[model samples]
Target: MNILIKSATLPDGTRADLAIADGVFVESAGSGATVIDADGLQALPGLVDLHTHLREPGFEQSETVLTGSRAAAAGGFTAVFAMANTSPVQDTAGVVEQVWSLGEQHGYVTVRPIGAVTIGLAGERLSEIGAMARSRAAVRVFSDDGKCVHDALLMRRALEYVSTFDGVVAQHAQEPRLTEGAQMNEGPLASELGLAGWPAVAEESIIARDVLLADAVGARLHVCHVSTAGSVEIVRWAKARGIQVTAEVTPHHLLLTEQLASGYDARFKVNPPLRRDEDVAALRAALADGTIDIVATDHAPHPVESKEAAWAEASFGMVGLESALSVVQSAMVDTGLLGWSDVARVLSSAPAAIGRLAGYDTPFAVGAPAHLTLVDPSARSVFSVDHLHGRSVNSPYLGRELPGRVVTTIHRGVPTVLDGVLRDPQEVSRG
Candidate 1:
């Protein structure tokens, strides 16, 4: 396979043609080589998702590795770190290996499985983290997502346990005590709506405790979906104190607020819940000034029936893979808080570095993996379900107008998406 992307803006502020051969990027092409005009599009490093629940190995009705990877490709992602909170939980070497192998079988993008922090994500005991890490899957990021590892002593032990192998625990920071029976952010909105109060302190306290614990244990800590301004303050303080803690704010948290859920729709019900506009501004500033290291889509996919229920009865997530970049481009780029390089850094590079993945986040140069996203920022678009590739139509941004469509996405020099359409996986896979 060979392609010459003509006259695209490179990350280094130069416009040049990128030539690819057999899925590995070759040098610039000579005159009259088989080429596709980028029409002066801004070529970017392919996006990476640090947190995504593919829902395969269980809950196939919601998604499979095939459909999820297809969704990822359509979303301009070259790789996604699959969350371990599956049916059985990716707590063992066998399960992680199976998920990894299935990703290869699909051959659309890299699907790295996260290992559960405790048995079955129960938080009862330390999972076989070392064993899972030692497997062919080489799981490095462990999490008890969808459930916080709230036991202080156990969390301390888990933090120390992963340190021996350079593993980092990605915690879903919420104090079970504070969030017990809670549905939305604790505020007047909850009072008016007659919903349970999931307080900001629920998130802040866990982040504070984990930061202290990480400081005490000298291990790395990652706060998943840091929502509240209080939580942001904690992360900001931790980083200033050199506490070795990093935080990520989802695209929803950066854009939407509790007001969206006033409709009482299930799609707006996400864990850590949508926060206030001030927190959203703070998070965007944090991303700009390096307070938040990555902007990952907590791309949780829920089945239609599960999400289409009453707000409280429905699942606490929304499919984000397909809409993440557009949301960022609309909310961040359109607002002047971020540039194209900053976009790549947060969406592609920083997340890969934090998640400890392989072969992603590379600069576009000779000998680098040819993962790329060709963007048409001038392209006006709408979030139509007909254009969505994910099995679940649970994205919160449906019917919203947005900018920056991904016209072409190349994974390892092969076009998984050409002209904004998902190509046949078999045609793109390396033989």
Candidate 2:
């Protein structure tokens, strides 16, 4: 299959024609190629997410790899690292391979399974880290998300073990005792709302300890969903000290504040809950200055029953895959904190590098894999459930007007989305 994208604006503010054939970008399109007129569209390397939860093998009512991949495609993503906190937990070679195979079979997006750091995510015994790395899935990232690896010995061991395979240990970074029964960010807002507060120290303290531990062991560590100003300073300090640490900030944490919880809307209720306006400002600055290496959509999806209940009883997650890029564009790009080139780095290149996904961070060049997205930067619309490609409708920005829309997504030279509509898999494969 050959496709030519005409008059497309690159992220660097230059316009050029892009040609793809045999699943790779080429110098020119052969005769009789499919042509797409991309006037007024910004062509970027396909976005990559370092963290996503595609609830499957246990919680299919919420989401699956196929559905989540659709959501990723809708957001202009070509690859996503699926979290390991599923039913059976992606801990073993068999389970990780199954999840990886499902992504290959679906062919919507590249799904790299994140293996659990602990067996059954119990935080007691280590899972088959070496085995998972050696598995067909080639799991390069391990995490015990939804449950922090609180045991210092275990955390250290996990970091040391993965270092042997050039793998990274991604920590959820929440102190269990400090965050027990926590509902929202700890501050005057939680007091005013009469909800339990999740203190910043609960997150910052864990990050502080983990950074020192990572530095001591000379291993790679990644912090997930960094939600506080203090955590940003700590990561900055760690990096200054030459520690091998990387951190990510979620879109919700970047745009929304703890004030949203004032309405008692459970949709705003998330783990490491939204923080103060000052925290949001600090996170945006950190991302701009490179303290935060990537923007990840924790992309958690929950059932209606799980989200429509009392604020305390509702699940601690919001669906984010479909809205990630729009939120970043609205909060970061349009606000002058970042530009299109920076978006490509934060949303694509850096994430691919942190996840060790080879050949993904490469810029658009002849012979590179044809994985890219076309975005309409001028498009603006009030979001609705109709835009959701995943099974879950737990998005926090449901009625908010967000900037930009994904025009087309080409993964491996195959069109998964064209003109903002998801293409049929059968038709795409036959192209």
Candidate 3:
């Protein structure tokens, strides 16, 4: 399908009437192409998610790659890097390549499978990073996400080993000792609620140490789901000292606070947990000034049974794919700290850069891959879990109001979502 995006401005302060033909952006339009009016919408290269949990090849009861890709399209994401924490753990080249094949079979969005840093994410032994890298999947990012790589010597070797292949270690930065049995962020709230205390130092200490280690080994480091003010300081300090480190803040962490734990709702039970309002303020400022490199949804999905259990026994996640773009649009754009271009940068450009997908976040320009999102920034909508395209409905933002709905999503010049509904990817065959 051919696409025509009208009245969109590029981040470099230039405006264009973008045209796509046969899966590539063209300088000029052909007369036979189908055209969609994009008068009030801001068009950008499609969004890329650096962190997502699409539980397939095992946990399909929670989510599959197809369903998660639909959720991603609905959320204005053109591509997503599936995390290594799947049922079989995505540690081997076979598993990683299978995931890449599944993404192709679905063909809704690009799915880059992240290789597990340690076997089964066990942390004691390193996985076949070399084999995974050399596989057809060509996994470029490795992480022990959902579990911190606690051993410093092991982490150093993993970092050094991946450096040979130009890969970065995405750290989940949490000290196991400091967060054992921890339910929420440690402080007044944990005390008042009588929940296990997860102190900020648990996260900050890991980040502080990892950045220094990255500097020592001359390797790149990426921090995932940064949740504390001190962690922000660590990333800032590392960057100032010319260390190669990048950080991402979750949309929920930027918007919500630890006070939500007072309700004892399992929906608010995230891995890092909600933090203080002061930290929220600090995160917002950091994102505004580029201290935070990007905003990742973390987009974890769990079944209803897992979330409906007692607060302490519940799962550690909430679905954010469908709500991410709108929340970022509302919080960042509405506040005037960022514009539509900045939204594309955080949600699309920078994420692709971090994940090392060359064409994933290309601009809507000539010869670029026609991966794009058309968003009506003025559109306001009420959040309803049932309306989300994902199989899971664990979003904490349910019932909340947000602005800027993604009206259309074009992947590889094909309209995967039209008028805010998912199109059958297989129905539209490739040329």
Q: Best candidate, TM-score-wise?
A: 2
lDDT of 1 by residue, 1-431 (tens): 67899899875567887898667677865555557788758888899998988998888888888889999999899988899888878999999999999998887888889999999988898999999999988888999999999999999999999889888999999888888888988889999999998889888888999999999999999999989888888898999899989889899998999998799998999998998888898888898888999988988887889998988888899888888888898888889999888989999988888878766646666787888889888887778897679788899988998887888988877888988888976775533
Clashes of each: 0, 0, 0
Order candidates by TM-score, high to low. Answer: 2, 3, 1
List the candidates' TM-scores in order: 0.97, 0.99, 0.97
**Tens digit of per-residue lDDT, candidate 2, span 222-266:** 999999999999999999999999999999999999999988999
Tens-digit lDDT track for model 3 on 1-431? 66676776565556668888988899876786777777777777898999999988789988999999999988888899999999899999999999999998888899999999999999889999999999988888899889999899999998999889889899999999999999998898788988998999999999988998999999989999999989998899999999989999999988899999999999999989899999998988888889998999999999999999888899999899888888887677788878777877888889888878888555865788999888887888788975588789999988888887889889888888888878877786543
Error of 2 at 27 (Å): 0.2
Best by lDDT: 2
lDDT-based ranking: 2, 3, 1
As a TM-score, model 1 comes out at: 0.97
* lDDT, model 2, position 78: 92
Model 2 TM-score is 0.99
C-alpha lDDT of all candidate models, in order:
0.87, 0.94, 0.88
Off by over 4 Å in 1: 29-34, 429-431
Candidate 3 displacement at residue 71 in angstroms: 0.4
